[model samples]
Target chain A: MTTEDTPNHRTRVAAERRGKTRAKLLESALLVFAQKGAGAVIDDVIAHAGMARGSFYNYFRTNEELLAAVADEINDELLRAIDPVVLRCDDPAERIACGTRLLLHTVRRFPLYGGFMARLPFPAANSGLLGARFLARDVRLGVATRRFADIGWRVGADMLVGVMLSAACSTAREPLSPAYPDASARAMLRALGLDEVEAARLTALPLPAFELPPSSLLRRAQLLSVGRD
Target chain B: MTTEDTPNHRTRVAAERRGKTRAKLLESALLVFAQKGAGAVIDDVIAHAGMARGSFYNYFRTNEELLAAVADEINDELLRAIDPVVLRCDDPAERIACGTRLLLHTVRRFPLYGGFMARLPFPAANSGLLGARFLARDVRLGVATRRFADIGWRVGADMLVGVMLSAACSTAREPLSPAYPDASARAMLRALGLDEVEAARLTALPLPAFELPPSSLLRRAQLLSVGRD
Candidate 1:
């Protein structure tokens, strides 16, 4: 019994090391997929990770697993990025306006993520730009605060999603007009039922800055991806 | 010289027959491509046109040329289909609102062209939609009427384009809600700076019925395209 107890500690340390390696591999896969589109080669992912081809096989049974894992993480982290401001803000109108403005600006600012999301070839591509997950929440909050006109939140949400898709697509080509953020946000707010003075004022409120995903993903793309660079 | 002039009439009639055959082949190619997407085969186009493989070569140098011509014609006809309503309307706001609403609804009502348009892989896909030629004119008219809030029509046009993309995508899978046209139009008008009552009234007025492209395209796709069934 005493001899067996010592072996448990050794095994636990080995397991921890293996888990860390798996995480590192997943991170590398995401960076590669972001640089390339969804149709990228599996060998590229392994090479991008700086892992041996054999090691990649040891961690992920198939290329599909790695691709799926990368996609899930990208979407999860993206939605999580906006949670702090959109979910916690006290003003519902701010929740809708600022949240939308932040999302549009960020996607353009981060073209690898934003451009890909705009043209996501996934079956859920329409839902991708629609912000289907968070849109209703924003609209409902505006309604509860009486900031928006009494209309279906769904309509407001759909309109905003469409605007985001357009803004993100254009942002990929050029920096947005300095006037875009203000004008677009104002337009959406007015459409949702706010008075002009209020819509303009709310949209003009200083937007809070958002923290982007870790820079390491981008650094890896620029430094390691061969064909993309 | 007199003998040559007498023979000219016989050659001119032969040329007209060849031209008709080429037009028929191009029209069939458009239908099959819309149903099968950009990856469609040349055999399918030849078969759809009711032409022999050799006849197809006479009209098109290669499959790529046929596909490019097909894509160009689809977009051209789609824009032309909207022209009678959009170009001739006396009221700019009506031109903008009705043109947009009808465009959205028609895309939903007609899946072949609408679905393909939503996912066009052309280098010009963005411009394929920006409806840039017509959108700027509509905006200027609204501004001239003092109907819209004084702002750049560019932003309104961008927002409208985004909305059209979303609506077109949705229309591909399921029937659009009957209320969608009215509600969406109202939202856009309000966003553009119209008063609520006016927005509601404009959207509520009986919508003008739109004419879809001739049904020959659909008949060809159903009878000729394979796999899509």
Candidate 2:
């Protein structure tokens, strides 16, 4: 009876270990997909994650499902990172400044995810798969637009969103040189009808350092290695 | 002696007629090229201009040279059209409004040229042969950017030029529905930091009808007939 129970306990422990492995695979997959793009093959992802090829199918039924999971993971992470900064201030200008800073920081940290986010259009029709990632930013902008409208400025949310998104996309593609963020941020504020003094004040604030994970470097190296092979 | 001098006068008159025909062909080429894009074949342009295939070579040494001429003609025409408007206003906002109104009118009149203008990038590098049609707008925006900078706004002229060029391109492509020019124009004004009340007033003004010359219509009809043949 003791020998039979020991065999069962070993089987249970193996299953638990497999579950943990799958979770780590998914996390690694998100980093890889964000860096290389959603179109990357499952084999590449499995290799990057340091997992067996057979184990990938156990967690993700297909690459499509895996991409969906990545989008969800990124969306949740971005919301958690940005929501607090957006909600920190009552003043609209302050909100914009904080939001801009938070976004820039996030982009710098997760450069690949940042590029993906900027490139993704405002999923108006296909909301099921890609919409989850865009929802937080859209909602935040919608609220900010309302606040601006309430303050007697008849600005359209889509226009503001388009401008900010374009700015962010441009910023993500290039490194933030000394002249860039200050010049670009001031231009954005001026474009939004902020006075010169207000624009200067917002532009003067130092941008924060981005905190990227080691997994990102690992994923990129994996991609380069795979391409070579 | 009178008959001998008459032949000389007649020869001179015939030469002048040939020169005028060449000039007309070049002008028509601009209209056709701007509509069809720079990549348009010589046969298409000849068909549009109601000229024989062989006649095109009489005016232009080659298709490339014709494209260069088209660019030159457009640059001259665009400058002539907008210079007055820019000179009329001292305030940057007012100047921008005047320039916008003029551009809107020009785009409406020659929708094809507007299409060509839309494709050309700002501060066009290859203005001599491949990209001359793009120079006028670049100069116009250069003046506007310098003016804005003179007022102490350190806005990057290139970025603002890109934004305005994008706006112009969109305006040219879409039909003027009730929701269009007003919404887009307002967005443009907001983006440029123009006064809201002033922009609203400008938007309220009636847009004029776009007029085309009889020869232009005749040429278009002839081209259509040839297409059916």
Candidate 3:
């Protein structure tokens, strides 16, 4: 009945608590799936989250649903972190180069995210993942602008995906040199039809500073891991 | 004992039977691991192989051992299939180009092998797997002979590995253009620092005919799956 205990305040507090519970489930699920591959089950997830089975069922019906949710959050967070940097670059080639470098660096920063990414099946070039959509647009513009040769967009996307997957997988497993991102970008640009000198120049262009956003699942996962240790 | 059941003959027959049983386990393990990821259990493999648990234990004591055995067989089979064609191309750039094309083609021709490959962890550039050893040699020779720029062999290999992994993953999932292999090779050559025209020419060179050896695990796996159908 007191002013501090109004129904509206109570409802808001309940909703906030629900949100925290759901996020805890997702963070734990990402870690479990990353370590166990596709074999991770709901029991393992609930146990990792320190939640009752019924509590987990409230948020997700099955492991696949949980996995999909985790992927969605991670993808959204990555786009948020990366799009600003990508937008700052005017040239399509520079966009691709900086995006590739930033992506590899980001994976290196969050090994858990990289681990899960390494295990996910490679989506087809036109699968319309937001990241792939961005890559496709950049590639098309590059070809149209004659900055890149007229390799089909599918082929161009495949080259970038391949390089990124390889680099990401490596980053997930171990520490790599700081130069790996630039080196990978340089190779990818050449593959996309930029001449050696041009490719080199674009990849060597000063990259903007990038960091995982505070709200990222990966950053939460990293903090959770540190907390556990 | 009767002459027909002489000790030497009995021993030879036992060894042959053991080899066949071991091969059966490997093929089934590959299929199960490919489909289920690392969560596949020994029971799943034995069920797929249609063998008793005791019989399975006779061949592989653990699932990890079985997976490793399968990997070794695949690496050996792939090397046998690829090495001759690679040797036939004397120029280091041609060697790299043709090798890339042939590998993608080989994976497409045997998707079961490709599926397992897509799941297996990507190896380090210096891991010294037989195939990696060959690639390292080609990359080093390419740099030494000035056919490729000094991008450093590890970075050079990473670009190729990334491209080949992406191409092989796609080839496993769906049918691609006959030109896909050469196109991928051309892009890879550019990544390795070949000029556009030269890269295209090397990849377009007449590729020596190649086939999976009849005795390869992939060939056997292909036959086994066909038989199941």
Candidate 4:
């Protein structure tokens, strides 16, 4: 009998199910790591996910690898959420405002993942390994930032990143604080050269789902992957 | 001699000596702490200053007190370095630029002390025993920030404080890199509705020292006494 027609096909389907279980394990790792921080142990992750001890090694080689994967996942989600808004708007001020609102919304929705990555205790960016990783990420954002700078937006990409990271960290630490979101949105708008009235108007509007032009998503994905490498 | 003359003479002489020794201990502590974080032992500070252990104790009751005093000294230097330029500039953008340039120069001059205070793992503006002591020194600088905000600068006082602290920390970590200082000054200027060219012009000028206006020194001295209380 053909293998596809045999009863053992159920076993093959079960293996596929196990693959999904492994993905679920990694997702659980991200959630737990975000909530508890990178200092969390494998056992704690497994306990939180209600998974078997033996099953972890089947998915990840070590805790470090798992943490790295978690970082990648969080980075991907962040880009997924905000990149469209950044790329869609041609006006620098409006682009920044939309991006800021989307970022605030994303942080509120996935507080743990966003917060943990924002507070990652990597070495100084000038240090070889850490710096390379940081610069890789910087290059992608620099593309958008340089676009603004070319058209009279004078702030450097580093300040933009620093301000965003600071805002994200503050929001993560005190999500329930009413003042944080308003202050953060206002700060970002001001940084982008929007007047107070305009900034407030932009901030108060509901953020719309941004649609990417043809090939934009693919290019961004490639750039993001390069950053990860 | 009369009893009144005897009392006054002894009191003045003792006060002079006490002030001299206190200044010496503070200088020593700044050097030691910068070289080896706040965790360095009291013996190290005393040895570095070539002072006797007994003399160190006579000046500071504990290491925590010594560190607090060191923080105060650094803050005072920072305030003295930037206040004149900041207060003299009527334009918000010019004020931010001048303030940033003065800060950068101070960090460059005393990289270690700047790094120690900037990256020290203490809360920003706390009210706990140590926090209260630290915040008392910070309040002077905080007032200047509020003044900037009062002049229609878009950045809030807290955000300005955060930016300043972040700039100091980044500069301390990477003094040779121009990215941080340039980005910081630009961000501050942008928040005040000024472009980078104007900000750069103001930052290029030499900064002045902070001196009390007229009789304000008496009030400052009273505030210092209140902090002690």
Per-candidate clash tally: 0, 0, 0, 0
Q: Compared with the true structure, what per-residue lDDT tens digits does model 4 show for residues B97-129? A: 666655655544445544455424323211121
As for lDDT, the candidate ahead, 1 or 2, is 1
After superposition on all CA atoms, what RMSD does each candidate show versus the true structure? 6.1, 11.9, 3.8, 11.7
TM-score per model (chain B): 0.72, 0.60, 0.90, 0.66
Q: Which pairs in model 3 have colliding backbones?
A: none
Model 2 residue B206 CA deviation (Å) reads 4.7
lDDT per model vs. reference: 0.65, 0.49, 0.75, 0.51
TM-score of each: 0.71, 0.47, 0.84, 0.52
Q: Which parts of model 1 are misplaced by more than 4 Å? A: A1-73, A90-92, A117-119, A122-124, A130-132, A140-147, A150-154, A215-229, B1-71, B121-125, B130-133, B140-147, B206-209, B215-229
For B149-181, candidate 1 gives per-residue lDDT tens digits of 876676787787777666655555555677776
**In model 4, what is the error at residue B186, expressed in angstroms?**
3.9
Stretches > 4 Å off in candidate 2: A1-39, A118-155, A171-173, A178-193, A203-229, B1-144, B147-188, B197-229
CAPRI level of candidate 3: acceptable
Q: For this target, which candidate reaches the highest TM-score against the unseen true structure?
A: 3
Q: For model 4, how does the per-residue alpha-carbon lDDT over A25-120 read when each residue is reduced to its tens digit? A: 666665566556545779987996688889888888877677656556544555664665566656555655666555555555444534454334
Alpha-carbon interface RMSD for all candidates, in angstroms: 3.1, 7.5, 2.6, 5.5
The DockQ leader among the candidates is 3
Compared with the true structure, what per-residue lDDT tens digits does model 3 show for residues A70-106? 8778877777878888988889999998888888778
